[model samples]
Target chain A: MSEQGYHVAILGATGAVGTRIIEQLENSNINVASLKPLASKHSAGKTVTFNGQTVEIEEATPESFEGIDIVLASAGGAVSKELLPEAVKRGAVCVDNTSAFRMDENVPLVVPEVNADQLKNHHGIIANPNCSTIQMMVALEPIRRKYGLKQIITSTYQAASGSGQAAIDELIEQVKTYVKGEEMSADIMPVKSDKKHFPLAFNLLPQIDVFEEDGYSHEEWKMIHETKKIMKNDMNDTELKVTATCVRVPVVIGHGESVYFEMDNQDVTADDIKELLSHSPGVIVEDNPAEQLYPQPLTAEGKRETFVGRIRPDKENPGAFNMWIVSDNLLKGAAWNTVQIAEELVKRRLIK
Target chain B: MSEQGYHVAILGATGAVGTRIIEQLENSNINVASLKPLASKHSAGKTVTFNGQTVEIEEATPESFEGIDIVLASAGGAVSKELLPEAVKRGAVCVDNTSAFRMDENVPLVVPEVNADQLKNHHGIIANPNCSTIQMMVALEPIRRKYGLKQIITSTYQAASGSGQAAIDELIEQVKTYVKGEEMSADIMPVKSDKKHFPLAFNLLPQIDVFEEDGYSHEEWKMIHETKKIMKNDMNDTELKVTATCVRVPVVIGHGESVYFEMDNQDVTADDIKELLSHSPGVIVEDNPAEQLYPQPLTAEGKRETFVGRIRPDKENPGAFNMWIVSDNLLKGAAWNTVQIAEELVKRRLIK
Candidate 1:
């Protein structure tokens, strides 16, 4: 496999979801055989071009994962709780995208279209899930596999680059001091370590990440426990549910949810969940309603799919539904869902 | 009522919820014996100052309600369906803020803190309701009179001045053409006789009004038939339900809802609905999560009460809850809930 196609690294390579996880692993299919980048000693040597090489970044410690077989990280939950177990003890299989080892339990949070077979239960990190719970789990895990979901609630609209890139440069300096009528400076957003710091440009910030004692907000408890551990099945279902209310809207790079859900089979509709999210896999429907065409975050910003639509139904709540997702919260909510779980761990060989 | 105290008339007086209903009837108690502003002959003569005198606008018609005793009518639903029943055939008792007689059957719709006794069952127009259903009925009518609502499911976050003042001057000229990067214009917004015109400043516009045909949005079927007719009461509850999705953020004022409800008594909690919306009446809780507090939209913009907070309880739905409301969609959702229903039709004399 060394004809040159999988050495990776990337930790927080010049931030903002690490330069879109190096432009979603250069339009993915994984093969990069060497592109380290790391970051955070004031972005080490600062440089990052990737697939047309330029690389540089370098400061993440624990010896920047020796022979780097694949990492990716995102660098914040305490630098992925200290260098993702030192790059899983040097064997290097990371993926993270922060919230540290996502509810640990042997960490496999993933969202390769809602749990890509939980990447054979990764022990070498994996995590990823919250860019508002990976676009509401790639638009409700294909309507919970042809209808059976149970409950959802969401209400995000999230975007000021999910609080990074300096909260989208403080929401474009609070929309240019609210259009030069001055005084609109807020240090960061709803929660950059809380203690009050509002002004999200044309405002609306129902806190995202940092409250958690039951008033929910560690981004609404990571979209209610990473959506019940990526919609756990095998009837370990633990009765689905999920709740969120994340907010932070002054959009900048897509992230508009507004779900609603509820299914457990009530004879679904809304055009059968908009024809099952227009054929699932990283969803796209973009509903039509006489062509006003739904799914917008300014036309899903530098899109990478997941653009669902106002697939209505819940008028008075029958089988329920309500949709209107959108994506690109730094690409499919956090660098193409962590480079799509490292391109499904390099197409199932589980990343050697 | 004429000791210089009752001939109101502001029907879209130089627009934007009729100059905040002439600064909420100069901060209420209704005593304004003569303020007649009217409008639409392209804002007629255009003057507009009010209490400090000035006046001018006029041009409405039906001889501009001859001896007008009260009309308020926000000039739009075809000029409040042609001058609110000709200002109720000149005797005048209107209130409408336009959806032109909300679901009509005698028009009462009011939301004076959840239907001020349906304003003594109004017959000559009372309506007001939708500024996202009068701030989710002042933050869920004291949790539906202490635990018995049954079901909600909102998700608004409205405000481009709820599509009025030229959609808040087209959301501040599309946020100054999106921070000067440009190409940001859009006609009026999610709706203004919808034919698509997205670009809600920093963005997000999941249709606010106009779609209606079982895909909701006529501002979500006026928040599901005006919350079962302003929380109806009596066994006439007609199965509570409600539902919405509204959206149109890039706030220029307020409206933030996110609800989730469901009560009809499953033994409610979150401190019995935050000590009953902190003793109800125009609610103002502002929840405290260790001081990051809650109700946002830039601190509930130009407040007029209704600022509720992230109430909680629904970690996985047990009687269900989840709050966060906010207000000022043109003050208490449309100019102090249409001058608090014309000051409860002047303390219940039920108008002229």
Candidate 2:
């Protein structure tokens, strides 16, 4: 490794995941020649502390990437779609944490532990998978590689933070009102711009995103399509089936999922899958039934690693298995994945 | 219906569901000659207000039903099993909320709207299906009657209250800690005796009950077996297959379910299903997508009727449909269903 440093820029620096990305990069081995923080105009004047130093947030614009060697974009899909190409055109390798470029034919959607090699085919810009997808891939890829994955059906217990800060605030306020036996009002989480908002403190909303014509939500569609792309690249099989029911829960930070999968190999047992996941990088196997050891959103919050438990074989399907997975939606789901991609870029010498 | 009501004894009346049964029965046509609220020795002497009058809670004993004409039991399976027989033997007709006698060959498992006729065969005691099963039956019975159901796949987004009052308290405490950026402590919900408790405020627990030998949870198995028992009595020629994945969510009250079903008739449409449900007693259709109207757990709380929404044809399979059904677990799932059975008992003159 060379001592030569690279100029880095963070897009959407004031957002929940953006702030975490900055925190994760602190004390890392990667050298930074210059640090650029960009955010929406509303948040531009604010200052965010990085490594104990106050970093002024600047307005995100195409010109902001002029001298940056690696750009981490978490601004959102709209901003990523508008400025990702501009950053790439300026010679900066962009790692976007938005859905904007994830399905783009030319952009490589990379989850470093699962499909880091996808970065080799990147056309200047790389895309980050959904937070929920990233963790599931991390846990399942090892099993998929050892055995053979056929079908995946996932039901997500996602947090409010997945929708951003306003959702978190809304959940807190709603719970306080509910506790006092008062009417709780909701204006965010479970689709803020939708026609109506429902209290999330003690409820579950099935619609995570506005419904598409086919009845599956946009979020559900993303999981289905993204898992196909990521698994196809990793497993080298284009026919792997994945279906997801993405739900917005009242949880503030961590996302939990009940995943049921059927493998092509019938001999794999729940213990065998647990063994495989325990050895997988960045995945912690917490599936001890006797001690009731398992992953939970509360414990997973603020942690970078994905926690898995409740592994068992499906009774109806001989080759099928069921498990529970939990992770900090803001950390491992968004920020840390983006940061990990940047670290991989430097390690692979993809960016200078 | 007579103004001179018979003597009524409420067994396990101090529970989450018991309180609601008292509320629903207040000022009803059924005469309450002497309102008796009974619970365990721990809850005895506590007073619960009914119809503007405070009723003293009594310790449940075999003699508790000596002169009572009807008994509503919401106690756990063990309590129901221990006491229900005594109540019935003492000339009181018992509507048991626990699963103690649900699949018992002698006990009639009754959902008033779907199987009120079955009340005639109750051998002194009637069983109420699990809460998740109750709501689904309300929403699907009509469709099944018309189109002939073949298979059902449901993923429940159940609330913490389904686990009991302590689970609800845990969720509240966890949310407070999450907002203050402090550690959360859990000791109940998702199986109290299980090794550890995790925050449910913003998370989902896939294992609702202890895992059975077959990998499916006891809760999941209950839904499957209960559906078979209930639907089996309705149509002789139809073969009904049911599979459920029950997940405990941060929701405090209502249980929401995502249900997919396939019918024998390919001509079935979402509008047709909605039309049948809107006219069906105990069911309210709230599927106006344009108005952003849907059944939410928050809105369904305290409501007696089951709320049905998100009704649409499944794009993947012809003649298949998907729907979102929400209901107050304490009401339709437990207490109200039991009360409805009492009403049916009185109507059928099963109880004198």
Candidate 3:
């Protein structure tokens, strides 16, 4: 850590999220004295532009983080589990964009807007929450602050990009096949490593990630547990119950969520929730049904803000509300969120 | 009204659902001696093949049903409101696939699998429930019968075909635009006559129909109200509270729903639900996680049965469960359902 800005490293620098992290850093106000981009051996020697300078991605290893002050890792959970620890041992404060350390008792899962203060609690690594959970938290945190939240049931319309570059490329190829009247082939959706791969072009995959305990997909487990861990930290009294159904849609970017939530306060109204989110940090409320304005994936693509709309109370349940939340899965859900945490670390001086 | 066969008239025969109704009737075991394919003047004189004979589409007028014993209507809500009553007056029992008579006290909203008994109560017009509602009732009716039902919170992944043939074509056009790297121009989806239109290819439109009371779209309202009407007739004790968030995705056919329900029987397990559905009428259970088997829209397209899968008990809440239900929106949701009602009417000797 230097007074003349910190030495930074972008692990997984040649990947989709890693590439975005570099661009976000260049666009952001983060003053970087030096930048080192690191990826797997296959991606090493490839170059990516950071702050207008082409930085060569080096092979990621234990010594890759020797003099690095801040390390941003998104090379997958296994990579983060192995390399992020080594980086941490080398005196680097890492903000990991994988689930490797999210539920770790020591690592704080931070969505800067909702729980930036938790950065002070990180034990060398601050875990970034899942893409779906991060956006839901960004939109709900504002409302949860004003109206006491008790329960949440969310159904996600996730984009193909959340699976990484290959899935998006497969989706595009599938569309090409669909237009040509050929059967679209699939080897990369729902879960690439799973037994079956279905075509997501103009279709939906209800399963995201492999099946976990009790028939719930691992993606669902992440959403269910991550929400509890992130929310219960700041909240001390009420028990917040959460459930989720994670689905992968055909979109190349932007994840849309249909969230139904119940509040402890019975009198909370849609207008009250909308007005509050409009003023909250990192959230943009676009709800106006009369004009047919609402959050959509295409509109929110590549954006840094979480777009919230369709705020309405459940007609049958008094204290409950339903809303649609959309955000760029790679950006707000991954890169922008990761970058935000890095900025928070600098501002709070939590890192070296 | 003859013993040889009933004369069947397909109002709006040229439409997506209307065409399917004609096909369903041809594929059904119902005895049909003659076929009258009626549509607007625009589609008049268009030829449709039925029962191996070519039939010319006639303009749907009040007099179109004079010699018809049974009429299947799906032109539009307004067309049904104006012409269906006229057909009824002509002594043609009509099964309507529009919203005009669904809630009418005189008309019984029927999904024969769930409420065939209600079909006997229809005063001339039997309303086919909304496509989304039809599939949901088919899956849950069996569950409600065995395990006492209390509440439902559903989020839908609806297809563009639900808006009719034009929207489906628009979605294709939008997909073509997306592949060519051009901005997709959309003017059909969400709702044709609504204030705004958004592209559904590789994207999601949160608004399904025009916004109704409490910011819920008319589509959501239909799912809410129609579900209650069809479910309450069978069971009288428990109040079924239903709420929905209906979204239009890029798919051309099939609608998928994420349903969360609380059963009155606390100990109902996923195996119990899956076992019950496997034997349920007009329902298919495909819930195997290890093989990545579940109800997906692509596989459900063109199928008559409602496919249920991903049945899992809520990990956090006892007595609650989450499931995924998918069915061809045109067939099971509209055409096949209407045809089944026609068959039931004949079987019960209630028609003519």
Candidate 4:
């Protein structure tokens, strides 16, 4: 690796998250000597603008990472599994946006704010946590630091972009069809790999990703396991309980989570938790109910900060409190988080 | 009330729920000799077709209930508070859908499937619980009865129709504006009484009603209080604890809820709970995650039965289980529940 400037390569450069990663790099403070855009063979001929320069994407293969200093991967789970190992073997530090390496014991799942120090433990690959888990960790890490966290029950209102660009296109197209009083069709949503597809236009689907054997969807399990791995580091610890219901709403960008959590300290008030989050990094508190101020998906679409509001102490459980958290699933949840992890690797000089 | 037939007056007949009540009556097995459509003076000239008959709407006043045997009220709370007692004084047994009499000690908050027995004790007014509460009551009453429920943690994804027709129109108009790349204006969502209005087209609003003391929104409080009243007539008994976070989504008709409940009996499996709900009245168990069969708002839009799915035993809490419930907010949540109450009064021969 060169100290003067770094040669960066973006895997899956033509996809939704990959394009956002390139945009994040353009707006970021990272010094770049050169840029390489790589995508699948079908998308290799496409041209994407990075830092106001037209860069042609090449077909992604093992040889593409020859001199790359850092790799930002968002192609999907299959691509990441195939190429991320070769990229790592080629001596490039990869920050993967897919779930391929997130649960790997050797790979550190990093949110930067909560576990930036985990970057020191990366074995050539640092896994970027899921969009939903990353935002929840950002909002909850501050409170969990002050008051010990015991349990979490979360329900997500995720946007179409989390699925891919095609899901967004389908949502917009379905809305157009609905307005025209035509029959709406769905070919990609909830879980594209699954048998049935449901239209998310003006509807709420309770499934995200495929269902697991025990009835929880894969998306829910990701939040459960990823949160545990990112927070505990000790995979066997069962002290912190987590359960999630991941749902897809009609929004296009941001994701909203209704989180109910119980703290070890029963005396912690909502104001106390609010004050802690207000001072935490990469977190914004928008909880003023009297003036009707709260975090909303539209207002938080392009923002990199996790917006939290509607803080209320649960009356039923003594140590429990409820809050509404919103963040751009593409930005803070995926792209920016990946970029932040890269920045941490640079700040700590963790890249080999 | 005569055994042959009954004269029914539908308050707020030109509104969303009011119109649905008329439709339900037309399709119901209950004998209706006469139908009186009543609304504000503005809607007096409007005509509504009931059972294929074009009926003219009249201004709702105390005199409108002179010959009315049952008054189905869905107007705003203020109108219900002012005119409902007047209608009751004219010997009409009123099933009010507004929150005007819900918290009144003498008024019975009845979800017919759960608390139709309490309808006999109503002093001229039977309170139809909030739309969110009605669906939750239908889904949970079965479980509570079979397993002995102890606690409830619910998060609602409510539809536009829950707020009335203007909110539904605003949601559609906002979607159209968003599609046209124009600035979307919202004058009726989240809370029209509040100073600020956020677009519900591609966003979610955390606050359904105005904020109450202790940081819970008014809509959340209604779910908390109304559930207690319908489930347990004795409010002093604090055995059942209910907490809620109500959110308004972009869906046009149905309301979806993610519910986590702890049962008094710890040995009940997820299948046991599902089987319990499958046999319960007015409940439809749609829980087959392996086949991608689950309850969704789009699928539950026009259905009268409350759909329950995604039943999973909680790994953290021994006695707890999580489930998803959805139903048409306009149908089962308001109009259907109100009409069912009237049918109960008819069956019991309590109206005079």
C-alpha DockQ of every model: 0.34, 0.45, 0.74, 0.84
lDDT tens digits by residue: candidate 2, A109-218: 88888989989898889999998899899988898888988777677878889998878878888888877789888777578888777777777777787877665678
Please, what is the whole-model Cα lDDT of each candidate in the order they appear?
0.81, 0.82, 0.90, 0.91
Regions of model 4 farther than 4 Å from truth: A233-236, B2-4, B233-236
Docking class of 4: high
DockQ of 1: 0.34
Better of 1 and 3 by lDDT: 3
Instruction: Work out the TM-score per prediction.
Output: 0.39, 0.92, 0.98, 0.98
Give the Cα error of residue A104 in candidate 1, in Å.
8.9
Q: Which ten residues in a row have the lowest lDDT in candidate 1 chain B?
A: B229-238
Compute the DockQ of candidate 3.
0.74
Residue B329, candidate 3: alpha-carbon lDDT: 95
Docking class of 3: medium
True lDDT of residue B162, candidate 2: 90
Give per-residue CA lDDT, model 3, range B29-131, as digits (tens).
Answer: 9988899999899999899999899999999899888988999999999999999889989899999999998988889998889889987887899999999
Number of the candidate with higher lDDT, 2 or 4: 4
Off by over 4 Å in 3: A233-238, B233-238
Candidate 4 lDDT tens digits, B36-134: 999999999899999899999999988999988999999899999999999989999999999999999899898878888998898899999999999
Clashes of each: 4, 3, 0, 0
- Looking at model 2 chain A, report the run of 10 residues with the lowest lDDT sum: A233-242
Kindly list the per-residue Cα lDDT of model 1 for residues B1-352, writing each as its tens digit.
5888898888778777788789878988878878888787876887978768787887888887888888888877897897788778878898887786788778888887766887887878887877877888887877777677878888888878877778888888778877778798688787776676877888888887778666666778778777787777322354787778888888888888888888878767788787878888888888888787778776777778888888887755678878888888887888888898899889989887
How would you order the candidates by TM-score, starting with the best?
4, 3, 2, 1
Q: Give the RMSD in angstroms, all C-alphas superposed, for model 1.
A: 18.8
Error of 1 at A102 (Å): 6.8
